[model samples]
Target: MSDKKLALVTGASRGIGFAIAERLIADGYRVVGTATSEAGAESLQTKLREHGDEHSALVLNISDSEQTEAALKALLSEYGTPFVVVNNAGITRDNLFLRLNEDDWNAVVNTNLTGVFRVCKALAKAMLKQKAGSIVNISSIIGTTGNGGQANYAAAKAGLEGFSRSLAQEIASRNITVNCVAPGFIQTDMTDVLPETQKEAILASIPGKRFGHVDDIAGAVAFLASEDARYITGQTIHVNGGMNMG
Candidate 1:
């Protein structure tokens, strides 16, 4: 096995996932980031190459069971097993409950919640054998606070948290930790398109009065994945800038 620690980050082509991958690499791990398309994967590879050749990217569609299995199997065969797994790949199909269709619900739930389940399942056996690992699932503030047009998203994120907690309990004895980092409205592609009026409204509601940088969430994830947080499991560290303090 390589002496360097390995980290697997899903949906890391851009936004929060990309930031987490960058942060983990900076923290001294060889990172493998996943993107849905070849182009995106190439972009991640170029960005991460600055760290080292072992820090690279892969093409993975988490919603597809066959692809998920194959990609993960290939990774395991080549890199042994990742010490850290970050489930950050997700899709948004925002619609009011009354207007939401079955496809919207299925797409969001399948990709966000079930996708994480699949990835975790694929990697769990290796983690069990290693007797050490960290799994951080990226959750959303909408999961707890709820939202007007994001019932599907909220449900999916909320399910991810529950899944993380249960998995944490099951793996705790083996020194494997499962936790969640729930981000509020961080500045990303999803939030960047908001109209100025809507953006102002959101800013006014937040106690910080400013949008959070991607690095804010990345920092929280990096901490949870480190040895310092070995005792902390089955919990969520919210990085929401006081949007919904509880």
Candidate 2:
């Protein structure tokens, strides 16, 4: 095994997750990115191999407890234990509360909130034993600001922040840090489909007058995962380009 620290990033096939994985690899970590499908995993492996052959990808469906457990075990067995874990895998089913079905609510809650819980639970065993690690969870502006049609998504993200704070307290004595990176309007596949008028409105609201890049959020994650942020824990870093300032 390489002497470099191992980092695991979930939902890393594309967008923000992929960028975080790339940044970690550049920071001298041997990254293992996860995707929901085999094809996506293969693509992640190919893209990361450009950085180095030491990087790898796994098929992980965080909503599936059995599959998630097995994947984590396999990764641990192969790469030992990861020094950093990025819980970036999340899904959205946007709808007004009255219109939201049970399935939609359950799916969003399971994948976004509970899914993160599972990933952290599996990592805690190894990290607690090692007595050193970092966990960064990706949250959203909607979680704090509360959009009209995103009840489920907002709840899940809000729950994530609470979970991070509680977990940080639980593991701080072990030198394991848990924090959150809450992003605003980042340009991604999900945002690309917005109507031109909607995009303009979003741009006008941001003090920066522009959407954030994937690299912007990636940089925040990298900082929290690095020794530079050792003294920081149980806090949320908002990378929202002045969209929602305290």
Q: Return the lDDT, model 1, position 63.
A: 93
165-202 in candidate 2: lDDT tens per residue?
A: 99999999999999999999999998899999999999
Q: Over the full model, what C-alpha lDDT does candidate 1 score relative to the true structure?
A: 0.94
Q: Residue 25 of model 2: what lDDT?
A: 92
TM values, all candidates: 0.98, 0.99
Question: Residue-wise lDDT of candidate 1 within 1-246, one digit each (tens)?
Answer: 557899999999889998999999889898999999999999889998977887888999999999999999999998889999999999999888999999999999999999999999999999999999999999989999999999999999999999999999899999999999999989988788999999999999899999999999999999999999999999999887799998
- Candidate 2 ranges beyond 4 A from true positions: none
Candidate 1 colliding pairs, count: 0
Task: Determine which window of 10 residues in candidate 1 has minimal summed lDDT.
Answer: 48-57
